[model samples]
Target: ACDVFSIRAQTASPPAAATAAPAQTANAPGAPQHFGRSAGNGPAAATGLWDYFWRGLTENYFNFAGRARRKEYWGFCLFWTIALVVVVGAGLFIDDTMGDPDGSELPVVTVGLCGIFLLATALPWIGLNVRRLHDIGLTGWLFLVVFLPTIGWLIILVFALIPTQARENQWGPVPTGVGI
Candidate 1:
């Protein structure tokens, strides 16, 4: 049986193209190679708003190395805000429809759902904020600005609005389609 299989294999022949070596193009002098997108051509350019936001939440859930563009940061904020609103609405609905009169004033399901949502998103929230700061050429530690009181929150708001750095800095390369 082995001899028969070997004989059949030897008789079979691959196509000429498959057997031939692929043509290789030599780079012209000073020609760019393997360089990613040019300026103003990042993921935000190719993906929809929801995709950009979801990518930030899922892809960079724990990523702290790269720079996040304004779209990515704001996209997340938009989705997160909408989700929070929805969660609040659900909680209110649950409180109105399912809460026990004899139980504590607060609805247990509502509180539980809200708490779970916040806890689930806490890490991604922090990670995105840190990356957003990195995009503006500031260190992630700047997130501490949120802890300062009334002024600290104002500062954080300002930081969130600041545009992405046009050029690459200490963080990874400038995000595509950002600051262009």
Candidate 2:
């Protein structure tokens, strides 16, 4: 009887383990999560607002083909912003005729170019940010908080400071390093 009992126990344990194994390897259901993971590598991708702007506009303009990592997207925004300032400054300096005080056609052109650059830098991110929020299952209307001056600024600051949700979310999968 003891031998029979022991054999039965062993057989039960194997079946239990077999049942558990599938659950352990089971994939979770839902959209892929993509938050706070921007350290993979495939290609350098673009490194600024302008770079991503041109690329996204030309390639991903209307193409919501894949998810975008917030860190990389935001990082590009920062880099291009600095680059924009520097490039605009250099352009103005060059337009100044090596340090002339009088304003002229060159200055006008420089100012116009700077305005265009600023617009180009701002436009795409606005759309991208909305799309990002949409991926997170949030409405793009939240972006309007930025228009409220202090309130908007505070709202954006809070959003930026928060950690992105991990795991697959409604935004699909977290973007891989290739800036997909």
TM-score of each: 0.72, 0.56
State the lDDT of candidate 1 residue by residue for 14-92, as single tens digits: 6799689764543656644432223332343455568767876677678776677778777888888898889988998
Name the candidate that leads on lDDT.
1
CA RMSD of all predictions:
8.7, 12.9
Off by over 4 Å in 1: 1-46
Each candidate structure's count of clashing pairs: 4, 6
Candidate 2 — what's its lDDT? 0.59
The residue-by-residue lDDT of candidate 2 on 101-166, one tens digit each, is 674445765677788777765655666666566545566678788899678878865665444445
Clashing pairs in 2: 32-168, 32-169, 33-167, 33-168, 33-169, 145-152
